[model samples]
Target: MAAAEVSHKDLETGPPTGSEKHTNGVGSKVKAHRTKDAQHGDKDLLQNVFIGAIDAGTTSSRFLILDGAGTPVAQHQIELDQSYPRPGWHEHDPQQLIDSVRECMEKATADFTSKGHDVSDIRAIGITNQRETTLVWDTETGEPLHPAIAWPDTRTQALVRELKEREGADELRELCGLPLSTYPSAVKLVWLLRNVDAVREAYEAGRLSFGTVDTWLLYHLNGGLEEKSNVTDATNASRTMFMNLHTLEYDDKLLDFFNLDRNKLRLPKIVPSSSPDAFGKVSEGSLRGVRITGCLGDQSAAMVGQKAFTPGSAKNTYGTGCFLLYNVGEEPVISKHGLLATVAYHFGRDKKPVYALEGSIAVAGSGVKFLMNNLGFVEQSHEITDLAATVEDNGGCVFVTAFSGLFAPYWIDDAKGTIFGITQHTTQGHIARATLEATCFQTKAILDAMAKDSGQPLAELAVDGGMSASDLCMQTQADIINIPVVRPAMRETTSLGAAFAAGFAVGIWKEFHELESINQKGRTVFEPDISEKKSAKMFKKWSKAVEMCRGWSDEDEDDASDQE
Candidate 1:
């Protein structure tokens, strides 16, 4: 079949309802993304059939159509505008996300068709989203109650501090494998309830629905306005403190402790990572009626794409924030260190789930953004990579890119980003090099903590994503941790992971063994080249930089004044 003819008016941006309805802003962007011409192919397309996967991330929304070989033949992506409404408060116009998804899907599908590849062959779709960004909407209208609160928002810092002062701090961590930090969704939910009048009234009226991005997108895609139901995958649900680690369900104690009504809020049904009905179908768009079969949090999805199912497989993603996940096999093991327990992926039916240990660094690529935006360093981010690659070494420099705070193993929210070991000899090139080193150092630290918690030695890591594209960064990661760092020829592993999940769910792919059967070729491995002693010395300097940044807060009085 030739590519299905889709029109701009087939769907209009309104409030989300079943299948295709979306918010007004989303419709406008779709209006803006209108393309006039596309290439037409004469030769027969490549021989294959596959599924579509949507990878919704912090900075971008991407669509990937993957074949049985796990390679994306055509992909399209669009970046969303990330807004800092206030200091330490992060938000996204939920419409931007919705429209971006539509735009990406249209472009990707258009590309495939222009190449004579038929869209009918796409069996299903998977969704992997930036986890922990909270959205509450009207179950009836499918309208977002407020701009989506990003995962890194510190508005809940005060709430977290108060909760930590309570007696149940340690117990909560033991129960949830997460500390009393503003990072978790539970505290964020509390802050929203108390501060946002719309949310409070909606909660009382029983019209409020809450979910992470995946749930919100799913609802909108499936007929949001009329048949709105909040639901999420196990991988995303694990990030919320509301869910129990063992049972993978929301805990009554957690809800009561937060003083939240169990029924007042719309809670999505928690489903397996990989299952057929686990995801719903997109009711609208060029690919309307496409089945969304797989879903995972971006990190967990990346874990799947990396094939880190067996014990010891690990990887790090460098994006707006840094996340390092290590697959730990069958059962969930609570972390002794300041690490979060997470689900790697759910391959089988309700029984025998796989688990993982994760260490999150609040800022990685965001640190680079800070350097470019705040400090006025290089013209563009790509320039930083080129400059860093210029230096043979860091020239005895160490940079702690903790502009926000440190996470995992340390959990020091009090620290600030700092540059250390700078002297007359230091240059921007060295500074750039140190910035990349800072990320690698923190990654190694989190991986170490994951090892200690899981009691499993890490094997070679498989990496993907924008940051993993850097050869210098990859080599540095290997040299610092003294392990082989593997980068896939195709770096969109997060979407690949979602596609795999959806494919498995729809029976297009039977088992992990079948997915593994793909050649999985062109993996570049960066083995340890630096001496262990040199690595240790570099770490010692990085450690001191962190210590110097400790207690970078202005004053307790400032925080108190803000509250008043």
Candidate 2:
């Protein structure tokens, strides 16, 4: 990709100073006009200002440098250390998350500058992070009072049940567009406040601050409480079970339901996903002086990167977990089905916030991780697809990847990871194929539920993320769902999404329509190869396996209850 041909800075010289022209279409008050670079005088002043996106994912942290055309120029990633001290508990050191982000940014920026690109040309930083991962930190010292509670942590299942048992608990769905689930940040926060003495003491002393990874990153980036750069985007705030889907702000009643006192517990101010200056600048580091311009939750950022901006547009991201989001336009649609209602993205003020219905599958690429790390089936994750490709099919094997139990449409808490119909004939390839097929089966289930909840059938599915890199898995997904699976040329759509939001905010791309022609090279499409009847038959077997695995945890729990 060449330079942007035209620069926003060059266009500013046109007309009288402070002229108002909507150059970038809707809501842009910036002066908009094409002008030859008078300073360079006949030479092209390469629109070298690149946008950087910090992808703080579940398992790792990544920094991607994207040009005006959404092409990655440089990238660096660091795998995060995850701790599981107890069964079904997940946590990450808050400082570790911040350190990973900093390292990624420094490494990526070093690469960017080594390529003769000016570090000063890095205009802004965008942040997209794992949603619902709760963190509470001290205001003065900028240290986490407790480890960042991972989004998948189910330690609060009992507390969630207590909330559900409370009167008016059912009204939370209507109030916050979320169910009383253990996945939400509020439940995790409640657990921290109740169980962790440090967190409770911090809150009581009015020095506690709550934020997801995005807000945490922003706080540190902007120099912490002294700089007062604690702000979360609408997309990230939507996952907290505190923000109102309609107002796009934190609801008092929802906060009260969680028993959170705002005065004692300082929450980040909810801001638009993309803004000119709210998130503040990187006060220090190699990328110092770069402004933090855009922020979004990971799934919502994936939606933006895939350009699923229209009503009924949908995309599935197969990261550590898989998330399928169906865009429902400006209005939030509360899901009667098992899906979650969330803000897809908000460009800025005056632009309507896009809403979505999302179905989250907790075991996607991580299932492959289990094969690589726990079972030692493969040296690397990519080999699972290669091993599976050796076998024509699953060989009558069915794997229910419920390591953390099923999510979305099938909220089966009692199920564990199960491999059914494993005969002597079952080889490594059979198990490998079954594992990959398990994700596809769950995806098909989510898609079915999405269609039911949204009252709209998907024409095609746009996919990105680590697992979508496998052609076998994608083909299996297409076959199981009987829908075309579309993948972008650059599979780093998650990072690109954050870049897009940042670039748009600073007028690099000018308008949303400008992105339609970008990042389109080498896009692949997988059409359904198997017959619908065959798909149905295979899915029926998977459904049966899912049923067979249910209540494995419950039986033990029931025995314990009886003993009590």
> Model 1 — TM-score against the truth?
0.88
Candidate models: Cα lDDT each: 0.73, 0.80
Clashing pairs for predicted structure model 1, backbone only: 17-223, 17-224, 17-225, 18-223, 19-222, 19-223, 19-283, 19-284, 230-268, 231-268
Error of 2 at 271 (Å): 0.4
Question: What lDDT tens digits, residue by residue, belong to model 1 across residues 1-564?
Answer: 000001111111111112221222211110111112223222133227778988788877888887777767898877678798666778889988888888899999999888888878898899899888888887767888889888887766556777888765667765666787768788878887877888888999998888998998888788777656467988888888888877888888777778888899878898888777656688876788877888889888888877777777787766777788887788777888778887778765754678888888777676666666787777666556666756678888888876556777688776667787789998877887788778789988887777777676677776665566555676678888877776665566777788888888877766565556342555556667678998888787777777888887553521321321
Candidate 1, superposed: residue stretches over 4 Å from native? 1-47, 348-351, 517-519, 555-564
Tens-digit lDDT track of model 2 for 1-564: 000001111111122122233322221122212222212211123235588999888888889898776768898888789798766788889998889999999999999889999887888888888888999989878888888888887777667767888887989888677788778899888888888888888999999989998999998888876797789999888889989889988899898988888999888999898998888989789988888899989999899999999999999988777889899998988888888888999998678899999888888877887887888988877777667767777889999998777888788767788999988899988898898888899899988888898888999999888777666677679889998887775677888889888887887755676677656756666667778999999999999999999877653342211110
Model 2: pairs clashing at backbone N, Cα or C within 3 Å:
none
Cα lDDT over the full model 2:
0.80
TM-score (all chains, Cα) for each model:
0.88, 0.90
